[model samples]
Target: MVHSRVSINIDSWKKVSKANKDQIFKEIHHDYAVEDNIKKPLLKKLGKMHRDWRNRLRSGF
Candidate 1:
């Protein structure tokens, strides 16, 4: 599936469809490979984690 290059706000994550959310999770897992063996989390929790991670990365710079 071809994912668009649109930038989705973390706040909107929970509003997206389950398929889209799953795609997002798959993309993140593909890049980071950290979701292996972990139970999939709810979209809200996923968004929070993504937001926190982005903040940490930004702060480290």
Candidate 2:
């Protein structure tokens, strides 16, 4: 059997204020699934979360 490990940056989330965290969670929850049936996969290298993080900070995602 093969096991996979997933890691999240808790410190980063801790830095954000409660209100901002709520907003971020709401945004993420709503957009969790795309309206379009076709699904987009995250980049194999930087991964999905990082791509989303960068897009949120910058314009033109």
Candidate 3:
């Protein structure tokens, strides 16, 4: 059995205000923009696969 540990520094996070959270979200959104470009194509492919599966199920195949 493997155990994973999860620890959070609540005091440090509590020090962050709404402004800090907004700035962090802005930075994350910017980073996600880059990843989203790469992910878009993969997501489209997956969507197609999902549609195909749904169609097959509907057709009783």
Per-residue alpha-carbon lDDT of model 1 for 17-52, expressed as tens digits? 988767765676565655534523443465566668
Q: What digit string (tens of lDDT, one per residue) describes model 2 on residues 11-38?
A: 3664578887677556544656654333
Which candidate leads the pack in lDDT? 1
Query: Which 10 residues in a row give candidate 2 its minimum summed lDDT?
Result: 37-46
Name the candidate that leads on TM-score: 3
Reference-based lDDT, each prediction: 0.58, 0.51, 0.56
lDDT of 2: 0.51
Q: Give the higher-lDDT candidate: 1 or 3.
A: 1
TM per candidate: 0.35, 0.36, 0.41
TM-score of candidate 1 versus the correct structure, residues matched by position: 0.35
lDDT of 3 by residue, 1-61 (tens): 7633332222344546978767755654455666766755654564566557758978999
Candidate ranking under lDDT, highest first, comes to 1, 3, 2
